[model samples]
Target: MAGVRQFDEDSAFEQALEVFRAKGYRATSMLDLAKSTGVQRGSLYNAYGDKEEIFSRVFERYADRFVADARVALNKAGLREALVEFFVFAIRSITQGSPARGCLSTKIAVEIASESPRQQELVKKMLDELEDVLVGVLQSPEARAQLVIPPRQAARIIVTMTRGIAVMERVYSDPKRLRQTASALIDTMVRPG
Candidate 1:
């Protein structure tokens, strides 16, 4: 294989995603990407296009995993259990690895989405997927009998609370307290009125 360079894209994406997630989109430079990925700056540009495009790729990778996790959470037998699993998934996602990186879609949704239409659409897509799953869960037989609010409103509240937990995890490192708070909120939100 003449002139063929071999490299692990998943490994590169992991390295690059960590740097972007930790430092954010604007703070990370091409040099940083090259250094973190162990690839040369020129090669990085050649391989992944510009920094903006590269970031889009990283965001896509993150959304893929998040969507998959949300699907698993939504698969729980009980609505309460499913939503609880979702909250747990959100907390673990934000708290993954050292220094509490938080959710990229959540972080970038606030930080970058407002300014970039492309990013806004991306964030909305991820949220929309989760919300659709949540709506389904809320419409389940058990959840319907104990409905606190309409399915759309309930899903919105759940998604907002989920994002808030992600943001708060950076400030509050104690998982027990966070989970307790989430449980309380879930009970309140889902309680039949």
Candidate 2:
């Protein structure tokens, strides 16, 4: 008899991530994961322990990808260029994706922040990480000495603006408008007064 081929854990996690991305964490069910991953419900439980565990795994994978992308953006030639690339990458990922799912962390933050402390903390961590990356790219010390705005504050502004843009893209299908808005944001940030 031929041996059965088993799906790898990473592949299963990727499938689950796609489902969770399309449907928010609370909205996703075990059946959904099973259907999406081509795994039996019992097998899913055996592999990942539980729904929250699976979500945690998916979240970790997603965060790793996001941070990797941010690192790449920050490593580009100049600060302004890096920031522009970061924003453009975000716009493209959110607007052009198959499921058209916005940022998973952002979606969860807006919906569940008030409901669970754990979720709120996760959201806060995600935002803080993004801000930290922005601060590094903006060259915080120089920006502060110039009195343009404090590094921390500017980082918060960038994260907030990006989050808002992502939310808008999730609801609106106006690609040209989003592209224009993203460009305007990059220009404003890059311009020296």
Candidate 3:
């Protein structure tokens, strides 16, 4: 009889994501994923093809979760508060799983962005969507009333600051400082100019 899958697909994918995020695409091996997910090497190959393919799935999942989580900022009461919280959340998430891991998208974007077209497109699409989210919020009448720059420009600034925070998380694990940095950025943004 063919061996039945003892692993849940969703659970296996989640496990694989953690491994990819921690070790990265070029560093992770099929054995590593199988061992981590308890799925066995042959089975993993049969199901997921190779490390690149598996990491692709993980990358897409990460993108989905990121965009979804980022939308939470828009749901908050105030635009300035939302921008601050949004960046604080990004920094926190980047620093969340393991200090060594940093942010998966940022890691891949910096590491293999030039080499991999897929990675480049994914990073671009996700970031563009995130900035668009910020633009939507910043274009609000409330937000427009206080802005020194255009909404699109303001959104770019917010995204840039948050991306900086994500990069900064590599060396800094202090959530308080991250939050303060984000708060300071927002303070400067909303201040009259």
lDDT of each: 0.82, 0.76, 0.81
User: Clashing residue pairs, candidate 1?
Assistant: none
Q: What is the per-residue lDDT of model 3 for residues 42-123, given as tens digits with 9 covering 90 to 100?
A: 8888877787777888778888888889998567877776776787678767777545557888888888978989879988
lDDT tens string, model 1, 1-193? Answer: 6345456778888999999898888799999998998888887787777888888888888887888888887788777777788888878888878877877887788788888898888889888888888887888778887777888899988888888787777788877777887898888877633
Clashing pairs in 2: none
- Tell me the alpha-carbon RMSD of every candidate: 2.1, 3.5, 2.3
lDDT of 2: 0.76
Q: What is the TM-score of each candidate against the true structure?
A: 0.91, 0.85, 0.89
Tens digit of lDDT per residue, candidate 2, span 1-193?
A: 2334366778889999888888988899999999999989888887678888888778777877886787676677655666668777777667657657778888878777678786677677777887888787676554444435666776788788878887888788666677678667666655563
Q: lDDT at 132 for candidate 1? A: 87
Worst 10-residue stretch by lDDT in candidate 2?
140-149
Q: Tell how far residue 118 is off in model 3, in angstroms.
A: 0.8
Cα miss at 156, model 2 (Å)?
0.9
TM match of model 2 to true structure: 0.85
